[model samples]
Target: MEFSLILKKINNTLSAEKELIFNDWYSQSETHRQYFKGVLEQFENNRITVDNKKGWERIDQEIRKKNSTKSYWKYAVAAAIVIAVFSLPFTFKNTPSDLPPTTTLEQQATIEIGSDKATLTLEDGSSVVLQKGEHYEAGHIKSNGEQLLYDSTKTTPNVDIAYNILTIPRGGQFFISLSDGTNVWLNSDSKLRYPVAFAENQTRMVELVYGEAYFEVSPSTKHNGSHFTVTTLNQEIDVIGTEFNIKAYKEDPIISTTLVEGKVVVKSSQTFKKLIPGQQSKLDSKTNSIEISKVDVSNEVSWKNGFFSFKNKQLEEIILVLSRWYDVDFKVQNTEAVKIPFNGVFNKKQEIENILKIIENTNEVKFEIKGKTILVE
Candidate 1:
């Protein structure tokens, strides 16, 4: 682990690959863990913490504060002292409105962080619950609780395509390596349907079923020029050796397909839009139309990188993501607060209360945790 990783994690700019390296270092020693915590304190203390309620205004304040350069300098000096001492590295969806606005519910609750978990439904409709430390296998498909993998080389010819569905529950996530070498990172409250193996000399296909996923597709050139495609409720993505993210949660009114690298063509009933890196195509569920726009790809797919990025995200959006991962519900008593925006990057492993505290610190929004339900005032 390098010193720069500490900076990246604190800044919420750490990538998925670097995160693994940081984690390995973090688990090695208690000294490393203490150093990590110290670094976090320095960084968080110096930076002007910001969140949704105030939207981009808070972001502007943070930017202006950074431009002053004094806080960052202090943080850097503190971290440098840590390096001189010890080394360390660091790393929603909708909601329902089922609460009565007149009632105020506040109770202490312990919301644990989610881990790798999912329900796999085989072609025969038999379901298997996958959780951390558990193992399951069928034919060439194997899952080690953390990830599911399929061995394409062991596939049999002339057999009908056996379909399997993987459903991710709230407060959980899972990874899968498909038969074609395509890698998929599934977020909380998502589901995907795919074949056990693809037929030779044909297109490989899968469906989002619902929720969010980041796909790293195996190029067609590697498979005799066979194509790969992903179908969601709103649009279909034609891929040619690319990495992309799709957000199509059941409660979300808009379906977003963000291309991180390479190429992808998003098709809808109206027309098809080809997207390049740093571009996102949003399909409105009500209109059945696709709109293309430039976006910060890093922020767009930050969740896959083990960070919940709230740049330009509204309170409603942030809450949806938080609710899904924390397995809790948030009731916004101040309805208009739902549109409030926040700007910050948080580690998913951080406690739900820490985040609630941050938002509450703004004084613009107040959150009362009542068991699994939070009353947002």
Candidate 2:
């Protein structure tokens, strides 16, 4: 069998399958190990542009020509396959809202919810301690797994509730369940505001003051009639019941709403667009235009799932996201560095230094962290 075919199988395998394939291939011969090393070196050196198939093809052909062996064809084909798999990060549609939007009930949104550390504030205008290793809960409110849950059924009757704001700093994360049974997962450096409970006959609503969040709204009582709406940055997502993710970070240029299930209408006070499952609606800050497109919802919501999945993301964009999560300041030495795109998925639990090391292995760039500052060279 050709090395390309072997690698194709390896790339597509899950953890256990990968382990099996690696063990089988590695035991085949010493030459197989050497070939694996060569491929690893190419990836580490950033010789492969994840989005540039042509550039990779050229490089692979050159490597084959220099080797001048009948086995060279396998290398070229394998390199192309590997490059395509890795380049998944950078592939993007021309428009943000190219994907179709959902029209069913069940609206969902994913939001970034924390910062460098998690803390809580009390109603007494005093800061309360939310130390790690401790869990807190009350009627309609519970927190576990670094997330806060809100169940509206437990609130006191016929009284306006005082809303408390929860802010998650960079490097910190949290989740929340609302009184109306809405669930939100907040990424680093985010915030959400909600009442202790909804008053009688009050509309179910929560404000995303900052950062990003993913929401899974409970079905409305009328199911066929009533609508649930979330407001942020001059935009409103109205739905009856849907699953979707919304990213409205203050620093980002556009507010992105990705629908995963049900139907949603993303409306700016002035304009509106409806989105279907597997499609996204984008609110552009500069032009103020609403763009729509089909997208892989999983990739957009990966952060909430404990992973940082980058698909054809520019080096600068990656750094920006990292800066927010790691709570570090970065200074890019060269402007052109912003144009360099790469693809990879990293677990958020990993140390910042480990990720930097992985990028440094790309050989095209190096980084040095001084105190709180990250200097990219």
Candidate 3:
């Protein structure tokens, strides 16, 4: 019933408690629904034709709520922005998850935001810790804290190509610019093995040893028509020049490859399917079968933009993602609770406790924190 809650719901930032409150108010009566409809219509039109100027003022105040992210004012120039809180799709107007909820460790057992950090294993088997605000250089490869950049301008004279492995720890993330100018964004608990300098006039290859990564591959035309291929356990993605995301986490049963731009062919032992933009190919590792489906590309790649976007995701699956991001463990005391579907969006800048508290307010479940482990019931 509160206008503030409605606004939060509109932006997909509704707290769990306020979500229930808004859902109740939304479903309570047709008049309430009409008022909500009128609010959105006003947002679309940028004016209020109705005489309820006082109510409209209250709505305006909610839109200007301090620290707001996706206020109606953001979509002032455009209309048709609707909140997909329950069934409608909340359009980003633009614009995944390790289940990252950034927080400080001062008062609790210590949880910090997954930062720009990774362990780089050089060709000599030596290792270097790459984190924000640090620098490292080897041969033609260099890292400037936030990203690892390879100098393609230099030529590799080594008879054997030198490979570098990057491993991202939990509560961390990193980016890499491959020797061929292919860009990769690695998620937490992910590893990528690539060459320091891609060989010329040959197929460019890399392995997603594990975890998730988003790739903006450099065009083959830049490399004299060298096709790029990404290899996983039982899958291979072939692309000439395309942008895509691959999720091959060991904990997850399915290996998902979501094509954002360009084209990719996802091949398994069973069959191969070519993916177009906005399409996702999910391979069942156990069955070795792949299923292609249309997906919301924004939801699949939202983590690249620093937000956790869930579209009717089960709590159990969501918990797994969060555990990896926060470097914590979670146990659900109530089996039934694991299947509960939830919808909302969260920024990684929030504290884990705050996020847990927000979800706890839903009353469908409660949380017990023991050290860094979370028990849900």
Candidate 4:
């Protein structure tokens, strides 16, 4: 079997027949087992000592070099091992056992992680705090702790359109179901201004004042073909029926809209772009321009599914996300540390210190938690 096939087996991407061939090849000779072990050892050593980008460059050079005879297979195996190890760091994987314990940090600090908490601003300007796991009812809207649901059965005659705002604070999240059956999940530090009940014979409109939100818009067919529009600071997303996510934080440098299903039209002051499923449109604040790209919809909507998924993201970008979710502040003492790239999948319910410790295990940097502030060095 070719070393490429064996490498595919190692990454668990091989067909069953290829896997059997690899197993038979491994058992054919003790030399093959030793070679595999040596390759793994070399990969581990390089993972710790070498820069990731430089390692890939070396692998590229090896691929360009021509080799004849059986020795070529050995080089191919080595190159494959290096490629696997480096690429693993850019993809989400299950947390391995035998990682460092989180007891010390948990015992020393008194920090509260963000949860399902939000403030609801009623149409009359009265604000109510929605605590975690607490049920609340006001007008036709009902909250069963986890999400707010509207009872469309208790509709009143249209007088004037009444607006309500759902504000999720730092370290908090929330969910709401509108009377029109549209569902929204608000991320930390997000504010959504929407009507208490959409008016009849009018276009449904809402404003995402700031931060991130995932929307599962109800079909217009159910509402007499009415259109739903979400207006952000930089652009507007018009939907007939679609599931999408928008990140428009006031402090962010770009406003991003990612479509998961169906279709939508994203309009800015200068131009309008139409998005299909699995596409994302980003509005750059500096240039006032819109750019579109294909994206992994699962990664973009992972937060709403109770996981933190990162792909080739910088340490500083990850830290900013953690700050909002943990309601903490970060102070980086080393400027270079912020530029380091990371990729991982973490449970949202994991302890803040435990997550930081996992990053520390990379040995590229360290973190010091002082109260609610994380000092990165």
Best by lDDT: 1
- Residue-level lDDT of model 3, residues 137-255, one tens digit each, is 87677888889998867545446688889999999999999888899999999999998887767788999999999999999888888899999998999997888999999878899
Model 1 bad stretches (over 4 Å): 1-107, 156-159
Task: Write down the RMSD of candidate 1 (Cα, Å).
Answer: 10.1
TM values, all candidates: 0.76, 0.68, 0.73, 0.73
Off by over 4 Å in 4: 1-107, 154-159
Global CA lDDT of candidate 4, please? 0.74
Model 1 alpha-carbon miss at residue 71, Å? 17
- Per-residue lDDT, model 3, residue 269, is 94
What lDDT would candidate 3 get against the real structure? 0.74
The true-structure Cα RMSD of candidate 3 reads: 13.1
Q: Rate the local accuracy (lDDT) of all candidates.
A: 0.75, 0.64, 0.74, 0.74
Question: Model 2 reaches what TM-score against the true structure?
Answer: 0.68
Q: What is the lDDT of residue 375 in candidate 3?
A: 83
The regions of model 2 sitting more than 4 angstroms off are 1-117, 122-124, 138-140, 155-159, 222-226
Clashing pairs in 1: 51-342, 52-341, 52-342, 92-320, 92-321, 93-320, 93-321
Question: Cα miss at 247, model 2 (Å)?
Answer: 1.1
What TM-score quantifies how close candidate 1 is to the native fold? 0.76
* lDDT minimum window of 10 residues, candidate 1: 91-100
